[model samples]
Target: MQQTFFDLEVALASLPRILEGLWLNIQVLVAASIGVLLFALVLATLRALRGPA
Candidate 1:
């Protein structure tokens, strides 16, 4: 008998769950990106004002 480190059967069985997690991660990434962009825009706007920020 031999043991293997990789199993295609097990991976295929969990594909749906894996894809669900991937989607969740993508959502978080997009949200974070928007938040960062908004923050940068605010900073840039303040800098344009030419006063203490």
Candidate 2:
């Protein structure tokens, strides 16, 4: 009897699910990046305004 660390069968069976989850993560990342960029733009604009502060 022998034990192995890598199992191709198990990995192949789960690949589809893993890819689906990865796609979902990518969508979330893009949305978050856009949100951060918008927030930073607003903050920078406020800082650039001429006022006493």
Candidate 3:
């Protein structure tokens, strides 16, 4: 069988690189989320403390 639009061999060859990119994206997403949460927490703490300390 032959296909023009999709090729299994080519796709299979590219799988590892694709997986690496996906993992990199996931790491970036998690780091960004943590940074955002920390920033928000800092702001909220400041707002709550207001001039108390």
Name the candidate that leads on TM-score. 3
Every candidate's lDDT: 0.91, 0.93, 0.92
lDDT of 3 by residue, 1-53 (tens): 76735778888988999999999999999999999999999999988885845
Q: Residue 38 of candidate 1: its Cα lDDT?
A: 100
lDDT of 1 by residue, 1-53 (tens): 75545778877988999999999999999999999999999999987887655
Write one digit per residue (lDDT tens) for candidate 2, span 1-53: 75545878877988999999999999999999999999999999999999975
Q: Give the TM-score comparing model 2 with the true structure, all chains together.
A: 0.79
The residue pairs that clash in candidate 3, if any, are none
- By summed lDDT, the worst window of 10 consecutive residues in model 3 runs over 1-10
Task: Rank by lDDT, highest first.
Answer: 2, 3, 1
